[model samples]
Target: MADPNWLDERELTAWKQFLSTGAAINRLVDQQLKRDAGLSHQQYEVLARLAEAPEGRLRMTDLAGAAVTSKSGLTYQVGQLEKAGLVRRCGCAGDERGIVAALTEAGWQKLREAAPEHAALVRDLFVDGMSRKDFAAFAAGLAALHDRLNPPAI
Candidate 1:
């Protein structure tokens, strides 16, 4: 009884393909955003989250978690966005220690402008590139993986 956990050729190929494709998708999406919208993918994510939040605002801490960025990185991004007139930061209501990022009107407009093109690029680069049947299977597999490993918090 030594080790039974080992990936065969198929498993190894699948793993490598997932890693490379995921990175490539991110890179292409980022490039498109930068070229078409003058925004980076991370910046787009920050703006998107803010735009969807109630009153287009979210706490910095909450945003950091949602955007999956470190505190310092979020701070830096927010500052950059502020300079670009895409977002504004303010003191959180009733919380001296809390800061909130709010989507500016300009930011909302920018998002509206960028969304269609970004979506098209995503569809062309990712969705359209996969067969519908394969897409469904991949989606199912991902959902199962997520559900098993990261179930919702009670």
Candidate 2:
């Protein structure tokens, strides 16, 4: 076999730091959202995606994609949101069997109420902690890595 490629010292350090920081950040956000909005980060993400879609609605698949969640996970989250009166499911406009998730008025209100604190948390933990130039470079690098790791289909 050809020589195996592996992470060098710097790459290994970056990888570990990236994973730990991401995990810590996710936990912090989830804790805040749970305490304030009774929502998980993923649930908030689902609602946020639906909120931005045309007419505050999106097909189930589209919402899942936008939220970067699996279909089953999205289904469960949507069900939870539905029970809370934050969202409603309906038959898709073009396909009877296809489901759509639509944000309710309550959902809009919840998002609005939760947004300011959520944004502040993100800025405090991530954005504002870095110099503007550093933040920009970090974001650009992560975007490139993310795109490479999850390339678009033809």
Candidate 3:
């Protein structure tokens, strides 16, 4: 016999809306960046992560984790950024085998210029449509789910 946990109509609608919203948000952000700054959404994420680092630098492995991408995928994306002169690889001061990825001045400038438009896109796509209280509850719920799935390291 088959399991009986199939989604009801409301659940199905919510699931489909989630998927569609996610895809549409991605497409909007990607298209905006590509049109205005010539960067893909993934590339923008790499830059954002580097910009978040102290001294605008992070170890490649840390960058991969922060960007939620595989090591090989991060390497490929970093290589592309390097070729575009947006980021640079520097030797780790203490570890011979570790390398730091640093966002260049050009990268910082690009991010600054793109930020306003990117933020507007986010607002237009989602934030403006939601109630602040509902959004907060939604974020908190997702955080709880994430903590449950990936518990604190102990």
- Residue 135 local lDDT, model 2: 95
Q: Point to the candidate with the largest TM-score.
A: 2
TM-score of model 2 (CA atoms):
0.95
Q: Cα deviation in Å at residue 138, candidate 2?
A: 0.5
| Residue range 23-140, candidate 3, lDDT tens digits | 9999989999999988888899999999888988999999998898999999999999999999999999989999999999998998899888988998888787779998888789
Question: Model 1, which residues run further than 4 Å from truth?
Answer: 1-4
Q: What is the TM-score of each candidate against the true structure?
A: 0.90, 0.95, 0.89
lDDT of 3 at 80: 91
User: What stretches of model 3 exceed 4 Å from their correct place?
Assistant: 1-4
lDDT, candidate 3, at 140: 92
Ranked by TM-score from best down, the candidates are 2, 1, 3
TM-score of 1: 0.90
Please write out the lDDT profile of model 2 over residues 57-86, one tens digit for every residue.
999998988999999999999999999999
Q: Give the per-residue Cα lDDT of candidate 2 at 152.
A: 96
| Weakest lDDT window of 10 consecutive positions for candidate 3 | 121-130
